[model samples]
Target: MWCRIRRRTALPRKLKTVPTTTAPNSFPCSTAANCGKKVLDYAFQRGLMHPEDMGPMTHWYSPTPRVFLEHFKPEFMVQSSNNYDHPEQQVWDCDDEKNVEHYMELTRAHIKHYGKGELFHMIGLAEWVFGSPEENLATKIRVMKTFIRHLRREYPDAPLLIASWDFMFRWKAPEVRKLLAELDPADTVILDYTTDSGSYSNNFVNWNLPHHFPWIFGIFQAYEPQNDLFFNFDRAEEMYIPVQDDPMCRGMVIWSENSHSNPLLEYLAKRSVDEPFSLGQFCANHCGDRAAAMEGLWEIRINFSIFFRKST
Candidate 1:
């Protein structure tokens, strides 16, 4: 049997047929397991890390994610574990008594493992539930409430991040407002996951902004199969400066499905926090006489996404 993991999905075509000793769903085969441990050890020993080193994948609530809390113990981690993302039969049907109980057990275990304080920021795939049968919504909400209860019990300072996908897909203000009613304004946070992708171009999630709702701005330059650079420098500049002055905007996150696929975008995201990022200044310093050509190059990449969208 074989198992393959890639950006939010599966392997690239060329690598799809690759073999694995372990059977299906073995998240960390020997190599992967060791690499994870090694990376964590290195971070612990050197007192160093990457911004992307914060957490595991979006659905990474499995024991696989526990390793990071157990070992990597980074400064921050995003807890994206939930019933919908669980690896079991009751995943999509999380209202089952056993499933509900087990989900809470896992939540408590992780929170205890991390040992109090705000070492983790939580995330949710709200669409994970809403996209499914509406009948099961109550149980899904129960799972969320229980998980948040456990998290807040242990890490009172941390916030539960309601990811943007909830809005990017079928969920909208009414559904979100209903859920928010259960949470404290201070303890609640929003992850606006894809501010730059056309996939979310018309998503009502970002529309009808509730000035009272605090949120983290995000940049999803490119997801898995289309890892090419199609980032928007101009849009980034336009959005970055103004949000800096907004009190409700809590922070920024690199919400890409794959990491390091767009280093310049990542760097600009970080650099702009101190001051507005200037493409001309960056190109003049890094690309020299090729500044104009660099601008033209970005313009080309901006439009490059249309090709990937078509091919896929």
Candidate 2:
């Protein structure tokens, strides 16, 4: 039977105290313009933390250099198509005989550096394979399966997190579900988020995976170019209560494209860690009136942009 948290039940009022560290275990992942330092600065200035009081935190499994298949030896690069300008076309043949040894070697190096519980939280494999267009679904599944198996074999205790965009689930839910089931639930987590108007509940419940499958509900709170906020804070206020109450729902991740630092994001981060948190209180503490006004403007811009793009 699937587990569902009652809508009326209050979320637990418990907050884990932040550790004094050079980098908090949970910060925004580096994206286009938002580097780690800028994220830290935003947090610090907002009184979220003081850098001087911080210490070294545990390392997480981010593929070194943050490039796709870059960890593979130079010789391996020649075996695959290279399109440095376009990330989607930068995929290689997963079935290549030569790729197997490279994968094994890469996994070994990862295990050496981030084996066991060395990773502070979870290892991300989204960029490594999730959205790449190089391989077909069947090949992608095999590649992911092999990758997960190798990682689990070497670092049995580390939590592995894989991210997927809404399109993947919308078009290939069954295959994705099957692939996730193959991994050990205890060590795997699904970081599923939406780029448009989708809900975590929809993905979590509709996917119908085992209730034990760990998940982190991600919200793309902000985006680039216009630097506008996309999430409906009012909706989040109502929806997050039930989501947080769910046992399988590990927590929330607030993502932005080029800027991880935003007022709304800062507020969400505070709310996530603070006990006895109230959405109303959060709005009030920050400027509720201003937030409402900005949200309205953002809606107008976003709607216009969508309409304009579609018409064009």
Candidate 3:
């Protein structure tokens, strides 16, 4: 039997009334303007980005953040933590002064060349904690805390965006929550929730709404979740469909690596304003195998701008 796929409908032109409950409600959306700009404005007002220009189209190619910043001209920069092969090493082996200075040099270079007034969103990838099997939860917390504290001391003005997988619960699982609470909320925004199927399923089923932890509002959502490689929008829809009613989910970051390989980009491009109460494509970055073209794999992340009306 073929099952019918239910697609989301377009949002209203305006949210005349705020939602009073968890049921899906309609809101006014823009039609004559750019939806991307609208979303970016929201992100900026909420302090999601240091500057107002950042969007999904922002690219970060090696060498340095120069070309990426200059070309993409993103108002925000997300700096992820290094994934350590050996998890046991909490403290760096290199001298603190040298390592700190080294990082400062890189930051200074990026700032001096491409970013003068731009804001950075520093991220702590959850993979770093798993590096040490011998380390307990307490150790992990200590490590993250110290690292964040150091980053704050080094870059006093830059904002920090903490990247973490659900690990088990919200990544803000009790102990983790306590540790994060110690940090200033203005300086940190937790990028919780995940594109991983295992984590998504656990969190979705256990918690009535997709959001369980209050500290985490922003999310890193993968359009598709499979083999930790390919993200399928079909999969993402299946996982997210059940919880679209939750207002706590403020915004999301499309998994950059997965967005390029999927058909969702083209699909969204073809959608009309009458389509759904979802983001229409604002910015997109393509992703694929570096060496060879992979069949049926098109990775790209897009920021939906459902608020704007089309210009005739």
Candidate 4:
């Protein structure tokens, strides 16, 4: 999926939404529009997409929210916590029965409106609990698990793609592990979205260091403010090669705060999975006469990241 943040589609028109399902009430979709799929069968499972669909396509697009919310919009902070934020004190208190039902309503609405998209093939809550200072770990986990169970009961169409960021900074590794272990493995697919740059930790200790679940490989390249351009071509070998060999690796899903700025590198992230990456051949394939210069430019010994700062 060529994910970009805009009202319109991407540049040069690489992606086109091709309707997959012929069934009634199904949404038009592009199963791997630019990348590569389960075609149309929504129940077939395999598809590619980013978590942004939940933002533009899922959460906001639906008319259902307006019905209940009715113009009184509670602000959504970066993290959905019980209590803790600025400019707004709207706590996503799962312990509250009314809050839980309201959450379930919106969640169901999201799936109903965007489920057939295939990229919406999997469901995920991007910003989960943020573990405030007065958090009760056990109670929070219990409430979340129960909520998930309710979702499982209602929508069994696709696997729940859980984000590692959900409990990463807020909890210890062992506690996170326990929460993961208790989840229904058959029903959940973990997206360790920041697999490439473990910069979220003190020193490259990713939230899931020793993963043993149905996990997908990911390279979350950009954040909210965006970053400067610094694409590492060597990742075709260094990053994806090992993933190709790992048994636990289900598939790949690339994440970014923007739609996508670098097509060549983005393609390589997906392309390298099926075959080895050759800078010369890859450059030759795309850059034509400038292949050598392009290859040389990317040969810098830096870790994988392409930061492009948004101007103030």
Quick one: best lDDT, which candidate? 1
In order, how many clashes per candidate? 0, 3, 32, 8
Rate residue 27 of model 1 by lDDT: 61
lDDT of 4 by residue, 227-287 (tens): 3234454542455545655666677666665645464355546564575555577678878
- Greater lDDT among 1 and 3 belongs to 1
**After superposing candidate 2, which stretches have Cα over 4 Å from the reference?**
1-89, 107-135, 166-170, 195-202, 209-212, 238-242, 273-312
TM-score ranking from best candidate downward: 1, 4, 2, 3
RMSD of 2: 13.3
lDDT of 3 at 291: 20
TM-scores, one per candidate: 0.61, 0.55, 0.43, 0.58
Residue pairs with colliding backbones in model 4 are 3-259, 4-259, 118-121, 227-307, 227-308, 227-309, 228-307, 228-308
Q: Pick the candidate with the highest TM-score.
A: 1
Candidate 4 Cα errors over 4 Å, as ranges: 1-89, 112-140, 156-158, 167-172, 200-211, 223-229, 263-273, 299-312
lDDT of 1 by residue, 66-85 (tens): 32233423232212334443
What digit string (tens of lDDT, one per residue) describes model 3 on residues 159-241?
55555453443243454545555666656555544533344334433433244332232224344443223434444555555
Which is better, 1 or 3, measured by TM-score? 1
The lDDT of each candidate is 0.49, 0.44, 0.37, 0.46
Estimate, for each residue in 135-190, the C-alpha lDDT of model 2 and write its tens digit: 54444566667555655665567666665553343335565666666767777677
